[model samples]
Target: MSTKTPFKAIIIGGGPVGLTFAQCFSAAGLDFTLLERRETVTPEEGAGIAISPTTFRIYDQLGLLDAINKIATPIPQKHVMTKDGHRYNSYEFHLRECHGRPMAFVHRHELLTMLHSTLSDDAKSKIQTNKSIASIVSTDHGVEVTCDDGSVISGSIVIGADGVHSKTRRLMNDLSGHEEPVFETTFQGMFGNFPRAANVEEGSQMEPGHDWEVHSDKISSQCFVGRERGWFIIYRPLAPGPTRERKTYTEEDVQAFAKDLIEMDLHLTDKVKFADVFKVVNKAGMTQLQEGAVLKRSFQRIVLAGDACNKITPNVGLGYNNGVVDVVYLTNALKKLVEDAGQTEIRTETIEELFARYQEDRRALSETVDSAARRVIRTVTHSDFVKYVLDRWVNPVLGLDKVYGTKVMGPLLAKQQVLEWLGEKNYLPGKIPWVHRGLVAGEVKA
Candidate 1:
């Protein structure tokens, strides 16, 4: 006799998205397992994450609102200024209107710890760390997953919550004969905790004293005042060097890079010291985000979520939140299907159709967000006349608060508006936008 598997859903990855999915599955009373390749929940180092209102709403549902509220610091205003320190435009987030909570800044690891701690002991037992997935096979009955340890597990459904470099994605692509994904470029970042200088406000720009100048061309820096850690600063090279071999940088190398950046910039010299910072330079890259039709033979039983399916630029910080929403819609769809099939077993066709709806609902939202984020990048990076006008004149006059707040940021907060837009555009069922289709067809593959 064959052995029976015990899980209703199997989540690949234990990162924030995967953890959030596990929580949702657990709440729904589904037997699930979350497998993570890493050994621990804490990040290797301290990195900042901005939690938008949409993300906060989801956190609220997960009963983590108070925990995050107590620890996270709010951002009262964001100023877009010139290299010489002239304020071009500014926008202040209306904290009260944003899901009855404020936009927050917190250490990434702390946030993950809070989420992980919330899991019930029974649910916590379901998480398996240091188990790397090797392959996935979609069969007539269910999905079979093979791990690096040679262990085999089966579940009725599999969620590829694994990130951008997902093995789940590779398995699906190989099974489908889809074209390989192309990598766009990479970003190098260095961050460290700094003592709160005397003059900095609760939520303001980081300057040595009341008067400070920031070098625009060399470095891009942001500071946040936290509850416990006091203050932290992150400085990124605006024009990162070309993509080279991935190699770990030592503390000495990081310090040297920091010193060079400060020296080259001149404007940041007095504000920060090489001795007071800890830095790491990691290659962060983007891939062209695309997905096949859910009805396609390739997409029959497999589904992709989060960065695995649609990778977005990080300008608006919606990547993780959007992925959570993907899980929300996907699980809700599965729940509805299970209810509809009450007395009878759910058919593969019904599952496929539900996933199709999920693709449609999520794809359009992803495209809109991706477009806006890329536009922001292009606008900020541009030295062209038209872009200058839009960034300087148009943005300030129209109010970036209204433009970004109403157009891009608003949808994340308002689900009805998003759903309405997706419904009207018929984005469900994985319909490719004509423009995107054309671009992908012509672009060189990496």
Candidate 2:
């Protein structure tokens, strides 16, 4: 297959998004070499990440669901509370019944490790770490990537999964003579993990809203109790400014930030304050949460995926999930193109058409996700009076949350994309039938 098609991919970055693309390319029988700037693919960082049923279906098709389930804790329950430790609402997710798979929460590092470990040996052999991309030049025949160490690698297309501060994105802009910023950072985030707090039940997620007594309008918090540990993320709005440049944080910065939040209650009971969790935190980091989709997802033969192209607030947990969706959409399209090309080399114009559709499909969904996540973060933080009323009163009083779960989100989940070439096994079919059904092997093409 590799020899048949002139479509080898040069994938940049080694995070969850890049790694997922690698696996998808391997499954599609497409050739790709992944170059990660980090020394190791699975860096032991970050608190937790959620895998939704939308993404679970893809993992199942890729033969990764079982391994993921072994390490991930399925979220069964959720609670919404006020800063004074008052639980306002509680409910079960019912994800499995509705979508066939539950929302699985796992430590970020563990998820990365699982993805890296499960890749085929042939696929694994193509991954190269400690390779930082210096520049990208696209020719009529292919794209060439030059590393900082003077190494050059060429491929039919270059994919940028290098994340929010994407070097590939920057270089692409440089080539096109565009200087506008790709994303905006409106909020700064802090995430950490600690030993499970006592009385915090496993499989439960807690969202404790603003502290009206102290900096109430300034922050929003979320915590999940996994089987072995607890993970938490706090989001605070940054002052309006030119915040496109990435900021680095130090230990002192974290300590100073934690000091302000130390007295905040977890809303489980009066006993569990932010201090209790902070004192035992095994790993923690601070980051600026960039939001927006890039204006251009592709230039010539170079394309962008994952956080490099679109970024959303983590409060909705759609950031990584959408990235996986990007993989499915992209791999399916590229696979079909390669197979259809037969003995002919794929032209740059044909690749442009593929990327145009890819960007259109992805941009639509990403825009919706970005809007929802932005609204959620704003509402949870009580950023405005209307949102405050919506979050504190209307949502709970009118049971809008449940309505959103069953009506709005349900249909979206049902329409979640899949690998078309791989076809469907319906491994996790539920009450809700998928809109885009895949054709099984040896089945008639629709």
Candidate 3:
């Protein structure tokens, strides 16, 4: 009689990180199931994502950049100005000469579509929508995950790729006899894109060389121009309140606010102003960000990835990129653990040791980034005293605009990814060689 290969992994959430995990799992010869709650994945509000050099290299290895590059734009320079329309400075931001990869901007839907398109037919078939997972139980044999339909599935381990509010994370903690403190909604963000103006030609000055960032005593606003549309964001740190709820905005409400934002003299083109762009972008959102992480990420049979593990303020655009890195590291870890079984039974103690190490490696990086994001937002949007220092001392004496955009902070944005450390090579030469730190699968760094 022939024995069956045990179902190895159950992936909760089929967003970018989940799908990427699914694909990586497949490549490692692991059999897994991917569950998504949406009927079909679609863009919630279309906005561009900054493809930092390191992130671009990873996508290139994943067979995604070719497709993404077709629709994405390379941002070369960023222009900084005050709300009063005084030009502060402009710098070569993409730093392609230094990093070997330009800062590329692709809409959220476009990248997700590319990720989905590149998935193998076998991998695509593993994705099941409308199948909501309710709870997870780790058995002596394997993990048993029950769906809202009362249906059950068996797997050796569960990976949570769910978003910031992850059901899988909660269930994993509950099942493993751990309790996590509730996270606070410290800040909120509003962002969306407006259609390109009629005069905004391909490779126009506005398209490639200009990203407008304006600062005032009270607030800061960020905007970037593209061939097709413009992306903008305004971060508002919430004051302490009894109830933690995000401010809601309607399309009409946000559009009206856009007019007020540019009530001063801010113009993309002579003809097309900030006021004009808002009329075109129909989809917009305002959401309270849960900008921190729990102390632990895993408990034996279950582990977390993406926003579920580290939800940061989107001000730095590190939210998804860091999550993607999380997927890569988690994937590498699981591949080794799955291989280690070697036809023997997987023990709870074995998985616990593996997961504990993984948590140690990832949680610190997540927390550091989350705290850094909060600090950046504070410097830009806090009281007039800080703004005075930024405008007078920081921008003029120290050249803060150039400092923040290029010199010191650039390397952190372009650090090497997991695949590179795994020895999966990319064609683009990295600027600063990132030491492997000996972080291969199933090995603890001394």
Candidate 4:
């Protein structure tokens, strides 16, 4: 990589993480392109995303925070309730302190539109829709990508931002002769608007908090407020059943799922009927978050980011935030490398050093997130004893002092500093650690 190198980087995906990476690359004066299989940016029916403060910070950095605020609903609280009209645990947070802004809920489509609108004409031109990448070939000089259309594009570096089923990952596996990826579990999710029944409104008006409701019958319902949509999430154990066996759901099945959900909530059962509400069903096939290294170390010019690399459970709502931070750290690291290369000599050795830094910095954080997310998912989806403790003991205690308070991030942020240091050889850009990086870096052991 040289100042006059005119490096061409291809990002294979146009989702939030890929788009954000494109923005950062463009801002850094790099020649980059993004590819997406989807041709349009619009809200998919029945889907919602919870925007955490860390994610808000990334949007703010990209100058889209206000736009997000305009379209999203600020959720200051989460409520947990029981199936039979009893409250379990409630957690409330003031998002301003957690990530220097408030958390919000937005429709998935609206968010895509906001991000897509921010792309420059050059960046937009670089995005090719409906062009799915079929394979990636890394040569001595550059990386060549083959798309479904049989067209080939080559670049100095290739990034696989292509979601969980990444073609780039497959290519890397082929290059390395690794075992086939194994998926551990499948998740089903549905999103739909419920008519604001009087009871629903009353439930919404209750003290602001993250709510979890557990029923004696071994089911749980979690509800969160979105800007214009009220979101209801139900998680049940995946068992062998006719409902679980169906690969795709019919309209009637979706309607029935909604009816059953509403009926399960004693608070809303009498207030609304399945036929009275509008809803949409969204489902994702089982996906594996890749584990272990595909190569001996991070490749010199190739790397994976976001879902392309790891898939954590949505229980923590950190997927988007963590992905955004990946871009942030990668961009800053590359910027530093660029500046250093301009001042001194650049070599393959220097590039390798940077890649090592990336792997060192990101791997542990990724593993930590993976571990924490799985723990939460197991707690929520398995073990009746754990759920009982949460419903019976944790809920009451949380309600008394706002268990999910704005201060929730203090400990998390502190831990993140340690992880970032392990990955980046320094603390996150803005934070000041009690110990110097030089002292801690040695302790981190690369």
Candidate 5:
């Protein structure tokens, strides 16, 4: 008779990061279970996600590149302008030329569906929805996670891939006796999507699927017109007061906010105002942009990943991609730990050491991305005179855009994390070379 292995990983939340944990754990030949609070897996937000080469390269390794490529649209150029309708610059960064892949945008729901469908049947069977976590206890031998439904799950570790308002983070805090806030809200935003407008044509100046960014003294807006859908976001800086605290918005608040944005000029096409976009909106949301990085992401056998730990402003589009990198690193570390321990139960002390190393390796990079995102949002919104001058003159006049895109952005993308158990494949080739190649021939990086 064969004895069953005592190592099992429990993943909390079923969003992109959670699903990714499921997939990666499966690929690493690890036993895991995923619990989602929602009844269904599909997200109702219906927003668009920008998939940079930094992310798609990992997707390629996971065998998800072709499916995402089919549904996603390429964003080749970005047009920036002032609120007064003065077109400052249109930089065709040639993202494909720089990184062998152009930035791609896709609806979040479609991406989630594809991610869920691609999982193996055994992996799919392990995902349980409507299972909200009520409590988590880390024992010497393993972890015991109790759900609101009175169900109990025993796992070697708990990975929290939940969102910014993560319950797992709260539970970990309670367990550790710390209650300090993890993120700060700097900007509030309203975003929505609609079917493609009639005026947007394929080859015209108002080309369908064109990316445009308009900036003002205290606010900035982004518009992306796709072949089938159009997305818009207006970000406004909040005053430094107690009211800036994050809170849920009601439908009434959202509608009133929409009214305030109606007269705003978009500079997308001839005399286009936000009202035109609002009239046909299929879905919209008002959100507070929280920005920060947690210094400690894991407590004993419970580890936090993705938005649950690091919250970045969305202007830079690095939040999810960075979270994916966290998953990759954590997955690689856990895979090694499990393999090394063989069929024996992983000790809490050993897990703590592994978690410490994982946090050390990831914290600096996470902070860098966090700082970059904060700066980008501030510069675009002209939060200060220095930021205004940098965005309005210095960057354009000095051609720092190209420098940032190549010199700075290229290296960052090149240094992204990958699954170490899976050997690295040279699918993405450009001028920059990767610093950390995935494990090859069972040879580990020293």
Candidate 6:
């Protein structure tokens, strides 16, 4: 089959998930144009990304595994410690052994740069930088995206890979005549960075091969160590603020926040407390993290993915991974129309059914992941008695790979019609396969 798209896919956002969508579409023989608000594909946003075995499959499909591995670190153990620097619980990072892949950690920028680089020349040509979308209109058989620059581009499908504050979603809600948007809740989190963690001895002094965390009474903190740079994340329960509110922080506010947390009793290494590590912090911020999936994922020709539809708390790094899988699911759905249209033609009447199926296929998974991330925040940040139970038996028993975590990725891919049609045999082999279905690369059907 010729690798070319018959009907164009207009992708909004040039972040990792949007770029991943372009790769999938290009590989699937679909044509697309990507519009990004940033000046370049590699945006300096986010940090301490956690990649699961499932995500590796997505990378393999996108043809960028070798490039990704260069800047990535496999997390072999998840070290749990006390503020006094005593190791209380250390669990073997056995996903690599059990699922054929280790949970990898990389700086957000490194992963995004590699993802953006993976695009073929043809795919690269589709990208338009600094083209921030101002509004979107759903037409009879297509959607028109208006940019802040007053230019409008129309396509058969419009996808939103924008972050939680998604303009596409808002436009979609307005065009549908719905007074309220689908999203509702958000959480508060504090994050800091440690540039010198790469110099610390692994296992003996700081942590194992991955990130580590030490909990304080009101604040819980975690740090991810990569090859060159590392990140510190602090999740603080909010004091009952209104949901879905946007927030901005001054550098002083972020510094003061980190100082207050560091001033508390949290330890990582003998030479460096987590506080000492924050003194020369490179980047940090406080944001109201959204935690709801849009009530509906698709509105006529416009569809949403990633944080645009579902933004969860980042306790276990669920949001970005889900965003990658979303590309697969959307690709599978779009491929059906492409295959049916004999490549380029689509039936307007069938359009609703096609997008509705995509929503049905993804909504449950989004809700599940959103619930699980929230559950983790509750579990790890519980009161004294609850934390004691979790620290002692509950967490150690459950381990790192939660029920819907990595253990389910391989099968998830098996369910996608695209990968299954392609007969991708390289997916991480799951123990119990999906009988009639399979992995969304895993977060998918099996």
Worst 10 residues of 1 by lDDT: 429-438
Top candidate on TM-score is 5
Ranking by lDDT: 5, 2, 6, 3, 1, 4
Cα lDDT tens digits for candidate 5, 366-404? 877888888888888998998889899888778776777
Which segments of candidate 2 are over 4 A away from where they belong?
Answer: 1-5, 197-216, 240-242, 264-271, 423-426
Candidate 3 ranges beyond 4 A from true positions: 1-7, 94-98, 200-205, 239-273, 396-416, 420-425, 437-446
How close is every model to the real structure, measured as TM-score? 0.76, 0.92, 0.85, 0.77, 0.92, 0.87
For model 5, give the 10-residue run with minimal summed lDDT.
197-206
Clashing pairs in 2: none
lDDT against the true structure, per candidate, is 0.57, 0.80, 0.68, 0.57, 0.80, 0.70
lDDT of each residue in 1-446, candidate 3, tens digit only: 12335747898998778877875676667788988888765445566677666666566656666777787788776655666656666666535766677676767877777777787898889888887999898865678889998888888888898888899988987876787765567655567777665433334334543567655554566676666767776665566632344455576766555665668544444334455555556466666667678777888778888888787776666777787777767666667766666676777677778888877776555766777776666666654586667764576567664555455445554443455333334555546454442234566532
Q: Score residue 358 of candidate 4 by CA lDDT.
A: 72
Please say which candidate is ahead in TM-score: 3 or 6: 6
lDDT of 1 by residue, 144-239 (tens): 889999988788777887876677877887887876543343344455544344323334434321212222433343444455443333334334
- Model 6 scores worst on lDDT over the 10 consecutive residues at 432-441
Which window of ten consecutive residues has the lowest lDDT sum in model 4? 284-293
lDDT of 4 by residue, 16-91 (tens): 7887787777766667777787775343545456786555544545566678878777766654544555555555
For all the candidates, what are their Cα RMSDs to the real structure? 9.8, 3.7, 4.4, 6.6, 2.8, 4.6
Better of 1 and 2 by TM-score: 2
Worst 10 residues of 3 by lDDT: 416-425
Point out where model 4 deviates above 4 Å. 1-4, 41-45, 94-100, 193-218, 240-256, 259-300, 343-352, 398-409, 412-446
Winner on lDDT between 2 and 3 is 2
lDDT of 6 by residue, 1-446 (tens): 33333588889998878988887888788888899998998867656688876677667655567887888878766777666666667766655665567788887877778877777777888899999999887765677888999999888788999888888888888888766644444346777555655444444334436667765455666777666666777776666743555667677877777676667746654335666666656777787766777767777888889988888888867688888778887787777667777854465556777778878887656766777777766655654677657664666667644444445533443343334334344665544343332334445332
How well does candidate 4 match the true structure in TM-score terms?
0.77
Which candidate do you rate higher for TM-score, 5 or 6? Answer: 5
lDDT of candidate 2 over 26-79, digit per residue (tens) = 988999999999899999996799889888878878888789888888876666
